[model samples]
Target chain A: MNPLPRIPSPRNPAPLTIADLGEQGLLQRLQPFCAPGVVGDDGAVLQPSPGQALVVTTDTLVEGVHFSATTTPPEAVGWRSAAANLSDLAAMGALPLGLTVALALPSTCSVAWLEGLYQGLAQCVGDYGTAIVGGDLCRAPHLVVSITALGEVPPPLVLKRNAAQVGDAIVVTGYHGASRAGLELLLDPDRALTGLCPPSPQQRDQWIRAHQYPRPRLDWVPWLRSALAQGQSASASRSFAAMDSSDGLADAVLQLCRASGVGAHLVQADLPLPPGLASWQGLATALDWTLYGGEDFELVLCLPETVLAGLEAASGAGVPAFGLRRVGTIVAGSQVTLHGSDPQEPGRVLSLDRGFQHFSELF
Target chain B: MNPLPRIPSPRNPAPLTIADLGEQGLLQRLQPFCAPGVVGDDGAVLQPSPGQALVVTTDTLVEGVHFSATTTPPEAVGWRSAAANLSDLAAMGALPLGLTVALALPSTCSVAWLEGLYQGLAQCVGDYGTAIVGGDLCRAPHLVVSITALGEVPPPLVLKRNAAQVGDAIVVTGYHGASRAGLELLLDPDRALTGLCPPSPQQRDQWIRAHQYPRPRLDWVPWLRSALAQGQSASASRSFAAMDSSDGLADAVLQLCRASGVGAHLVQADLPLPPGLASWQGLATALDWTLYGGEDFELVLCLPETVLAGLEAASGAGVPAFGLRRVGTIVAGSQVTLHGSDPQEPGRVLSLDRGFQHFSELF
Candidate 1:
């Protein structure tokens, strides 16, 4: 018997490749995944919320650069693309309204693969309480999935990188290095991160999923707002800052420092690696991945000490799975200094910044 | 002695290629071209005008697919990309607001070329009364410029493809096919257009400029709206439709017909080619380009007869630079029939639709 198509593209049952369906047919298939009555127009029409400012962000994912077609499923690629833009919106404390996705694909790409991508994109967008409003499709050598998400935030509540204040505490949502570990595992199962024992199958799957389809921390916006408000009540004057940790923790901290003209001192004791890595000897390998392995899609926020207490009080002191952790403090300099991070020397201080420059390095 | 890098990257100062400057450095260079105080954050914040609907659109132009890097200058590529999206906004009767551009470039791309691209992008965006509010940069095998534009139009005045009505006159803004002729001339100067003598130097330059830097007809929105409203006053009940002619006049007519469930009949005697093309024997070559050569970036609109008269009366019966030519009329059937368009036979009829499918063929 003949083998069936590998990827599930049940929606585009008739057309085998994108060229076979043509632009109209492709648009017809895509329309249902977008907001109702928003497609089939020159442009989508959206009404901004009363007394709200629009937050706009866009990000692109390329075939070989962002995701390896060999290892990553098409659906995961789509989810990751949308999530990157959504994470930016979340970092700015904005509620996502809609997005416009533009895809440039090679002509020979399978219809089923594109269908899976849209399914993933639609799922991620819908789960975030929004929908794809409009998009464009064109031909190119590599598959470039570019997404622009529009969100809304009240003017007084806008979170910004320049808002970080001296004496503020720096915290991050979710565990770092898990995504980096997951990616290395996916790229080469036999040779994972150095000194990392091959994890259990369940652990491997979870890590890989974290890397492939990292969730945006939009959920933390409300909790952060509430916590910040409570903190403001305790101290009348302060500046709270936040940004997404898409380009590694080191870069995020450095950017926040550069933008706000302040320094960060990371406390290694507060940083946690994913569970099941306990058999490892030292924290050397985990530290590198946590500090420099990018695409974490977590939130690195700076708030006053009062807010950190508010978060613990709001939760049950454990601060449940917003992954609340006080990793550092905002200081008076413009560099990110790590304390007790180097296992070779106790209380070792290593200054690090500018992690993973796109063109200068091989990622 | 080194030809000054062949392109002027004065702002980039010392960076030779995109890889040299990296993401942060490149963004720093690009910041001045965008809206003030919008960059260096997770996202851009825009405040929309009250009581207006947002018109959003996104489009992409790939290196080999949209333009040739060797022949098409970097600046034109940028201008063309912005113009494409801006045309869609104007098609919906929306005022230009701002745009977010996401570029995926090869590591070898020159900083000078990118700087020139931004210059053209900023010029076009600024000329249309807007700015580049946000953008993204990433590595790819080829160059891809994807832009998402946001405009605003009052809900009552929105133009749509499905608003065409029977007995409405179909008119177009500016000339068509000059861009096509220009592209042909640029791609091969000596071999110009088929079955025609070579164009004069001035004419060739004009045609080439049309193709390379096709202007979005945002200037026509006020004129058309006023004309439509005047017609509405005369009739009180009619549907006026519009869309950009990016996919050729035939495709625009077909889309409008398909969306509105109507048909169109073109009157060929009305279309006038460039002054120099009159040296040709018949209308065959010009007609082919007019009917099918895409990327004109003009506006194809449907208006009542009263609106046609209003435009003529308002503009001293000439309609001047608006290029107001009523070349067709909407009908009850579902096919776009060209009347007397076939040069081989007098009064011959030809039905045409679905002009270009990107993935299936060379553009």
Candidate 2:
């Protein structure tokens, strides 16, 4: 074997290696950003901040599972992960602060792809005035992005799940079912439709944009907080009791009711489906989609009857102009019912109750 | 023709689906232990403290990249992820406080597996007296665990990378090269050793245990702090100028010298290799292995020569005696060298000129 090629070694008398360089290099880079009570002798040090409640939420996006490697852009993937976590913060009426991201990718993944992902994340953090304090990266079989958002809520303004009461008027933000419709079109590209057989470029753009880059409504928190502060009436203040609705309308309403130990009767006719999707059969399908589709990231507010005027005023001032429709009324009992145009025709009301389950095919 | 299974008409109202549960379930489950400023809103809220500094470190573990699916248990995988992050904290001489874990698993993964992983994580967190306050979970092609550890250090005691000066003696906690040797046995079980091979099952257990569960010397922090506190001399006051030797000795020394803007020379004869691993050829073959091995989560300290006596006094008092050895002395230049037994063997005096490069084939 030719004497094993006589491997050459270092001639100097000191000991150093590449591994040390990387570790020390990282320490040098992070030293300036170190803050007290954040880094601990054993791990991360957390000092208690009494009186201020913490709102924590985490979201994960995976290649192939949540996004396709072939279709979804990496930038969009990064944006959506942040948006998903931020939306949870908004639902709690909490102010966004900082985030920790964990990313895993195959060794073969390009550096450009990683950079693009960070660029998108940086943009989102900048838009929301948050800092990317820390994160983890590792080589893996596929791409995965996971983020945990931390927010603060002054005691008086914190929103929660267990506060929705009976007679609360349910309100949803923005039109629904568009995302589900967009997904259908993307998944079945060759399918033909009777009314809008194929969307114009602009229409496709609108749907695709909505599907890919849903913005979290951080601006809504202050409005909700201000409305609650007025103390106008129990009915009015109660309306802002709950604020999350990402899964779907039916499921969200059910959650609110369960939390408040109540039930609800929803008006199926009131849901705002896309205008072009309102044919007789299409309307029914659109309603079903609205009731069970995922990734809408919309807010479902459980407010009292008196807050309707405030909501209408806010809508007029152009707060993203959510549909603000009254889809349901909280009631005593533990079940949900759907009401059609004909009050007497209870049988005509269709209930789409299936919601998104993370690991289940129902999603 | 078999009646095409009546695809549920899109117009029909379906019962509340599981997908509709949304994030509410997760939020409810996590609400109790989640800390404020660590969760919710736009980003996490951090309250900085005076006279203290934060230390943050992140680590990621992938299913196939870091551990084989067949050999590594899920619980062990979780434990290892936390251990790696905690190890970084120990290297900084910072106190461990809290951690955030992000997990990505395939949709088909069993719930029991997830619970087991969490149980392992919970056990580790409990051992460290830290909380798993927040994290994210999502579906992916393979399991990925990313952890971020946050630590804090009092201003007076905060150890740094650039504090070593000329003549500072090098000291290391615990033994070296054993992890690399254990890994060798693991990778090539049939590789027979001529001598130093453990003859009993108990001895074998002791050898492999060091590799699988290398404990972070958290309990030693207070002792180290006290020892360094009575700094009447230059060496005594600056007991630990730098830390973290996971990437191995040669790599670690290079980092210390580079950061301190100095040079160091270690005596090959002073290296503390394990009992069974000490032949001239074995030393030669394993010298590189010990010098370049990563995952040896040991702390390396640069102290003044005056404190050496104090350290010995403390070590003799049953304080988990670190295998303290005078490996080298800091010099005024930026070069690392190794002195051999013979002065004329030019290349025998090695210099660890580079830090360990991660993801390299040698790993």
Q: Which structure among the candidates has the greatest DockQ?
A: 1
Specify the CAPRI tier of model 1.
medium
- Chain B fold agreement for model 2, TM-score: 0.78
What DockQ does candidate 1 score? 0.70
Question: Could you tell me how far off, in angstroms, the CA of residue A334 lies in candidate 2 after the best superposition?
Answer: 3.1
- Model 1: per-residue lDDT, tens digit, B126-170? 889999999999999999999999998877678899999999999
TM-score, per-candidate, Cα-based: 0.91, 0.75
Tell me the spans in candidate 1 whose CA falls farther than 4 Å from its real position.
A1-15, A190-198, A227-239, A278-282, A310-323, A341-354, B1-15, B191-198, B227-239, B278-282, B308-320, B341-354
Worst 10 residues of 1 chain B by lDDT: B1-10
TM-score of 1: 0.91
Reference contacts preserved by each model: 0.87, 0.33
lDDT of 2 by residue, B163-214 (tens): 7888888887767776666666667555534345432444344445556556
Q: What C-alpha lDDT, on a 0 to 100 scale, does residue B88 get in candidate 1?
A: 97
Ten residues in a row with the worst lDDT in model 1 chain A?
A: A1-10
TM-scores of chain B alone in all candidate structures, in the order given = 0.89, 0.78
